[model samples]
Target: MVPAIESVGIGRLATCLREAGLLLLLALSVTVAAWLIRPEKMSLRAETAFYELELDAPLIAVADALVLYDTGSHLFLDTRTAGPGSFVTIPGALPVRVTTFDDDLYENRDFLYPEDPVVLFGDGNLPAVSDVAALLLERGFEEIMIMGGDLEAWRRTGGPLADHQAGEHE
Candidate 1:
């Protein structure tokens, strides 16, 4: 009654092709919609530095603490991105680059030497700051203080900050 059929499922093959086309169209539609309505970035006014951290305790006020070491007291550290914060720092702090840098900053023979309190700083917050403090502690430093509030707090309060117009390169 029926003509000789060369393929068993010619009709089914056509239906499958139609379904595949529909699925492709749906996927493309979703992709386009997602691109048109993407989420926005954060607007919070915040800054960042070499690391992110939460200090275990508050550091003694830079002004009244006399953080600056005379010979074997304490060491001021500015752990911000180097070459930029040359001037920006705590009132009585000094700059120290801790970017796996192999220079005098990492050396143990500097004037401050070992067994001194080293105050570390960051832009918004320094990452692995506790580890750095621990390293300094292992090196005989008595106390390692991690400064809070970061560069934003320091600049907003008009602390010892540099005025140079650091460009995007920084």
Candidate 2:
């Protein structure tokens, strides 16, 4: 009777070990299959298929813009018109009003370069934003990006902002 009980216990342990081994094998197989079928290449540009803007420039997220801002590798341009209202902008951003793009470009040409990265954003000024992007493209800028949302969006995304007197950019 004792031998019969020991045999039964050994049988249950072997069955449990077999099941656990099979489960581990199944998990490994799934992991390998997923890795084998993963996309060969990933696109860096943000998906803009759902966006309303039809401009040729690529749109970058505020988080990514923040990364660029941190690296200090990109020149940020503020495209909003300066007026009586209080103005806030990303730190180190230069004012380049679309209405005075030519003069602004001339004034800032030394800072503007075709090879360097440039990021443009506006305060609910989508049209002016596109205009600024186009103007920059025409001047042979190779890497011009537009921030996806307005200045308020930037503020909400933990981006640092600096205040300027009204019409100071004008």
Candidate 3:
């Protein structure tokens, strides 16, 4: 009787070990297959060159942006997020958030045109502005500009600010 009980215990241990080994092997196989089947459209060198160009892109001063605004030949994109009760933006400026920018927004005639000059500005946040500009460049926007200053500079230059929340009033 004692021998039979010992044999049963050993049999259960062996079965558990075999199951665990098979599971590990299956997981490893899946991982390797996924790696081998991954897409390869964007190469490392191409990605690096894109970032280099984005970093070295030309910057437009607040003065120049204002002039363009007055001329009505350029479109202004305000990438600033509203804080508390304040959502001030340049007059006629379209609001754009980097994280939420959609391709469909560009399809709207009122929002974007590929050939039109576009000035992208944030609340003095370089990284945020650069990210949005990079996305625009990737989407093949012809002429893109980054504002050299922040919202304060826009106000200092007497650039009109309209409350973003004020729909018809704007």
The local distance difference test score of model 2 is 0.78
Q: Model 3: runs farther than 4 Å from truth?
A: 1-56, 83-86, 103-109, 166-170
TM values, all candidates: 0.45, 0.65, 0.59
Pairs in clash, predicted candidate 1 = 51-126, 51-127, 52-126, 52-127, 88-162
lDDT of 3 at 63: 77
Q: Which candidate is the best by TM-score?
A: 2
Off by over 4 Å in 1: 1-73, 83-87, 106-108, 163-170
Q: Is candidate 1 or candidate 2 better by lDDT?
A: 2
- lDDT minimum window of 10 residues, candidate 1: 161-170
TM-score of 2: 0.65
Please write out the lDDT profile of model 3 over residues 28-83, one tens digit for every residue.
99977776775422233544433454442467878778888888888888766554
Score residue 135 of candidate 2 by CA lDDT.
Answer: 84
Off by over 4 Å in 2: 1-50, 84-86, 165-170
Question: What tens digits encode model 1's per-residue C-alpha lDDT throughout 1-170?
Answer: 87787565989898889999999999999977776664422224554442243554345433323324334355666556556433544454544445642353444344456666576666644454554555556657666777654666555444555443222112
RMSD of each: 16.5, 11.9, 18.8
Candidate 1 Cα deviation (angstroms), residue 106: 5.2
Score candidate 1 by TM-score against the native: 0.45
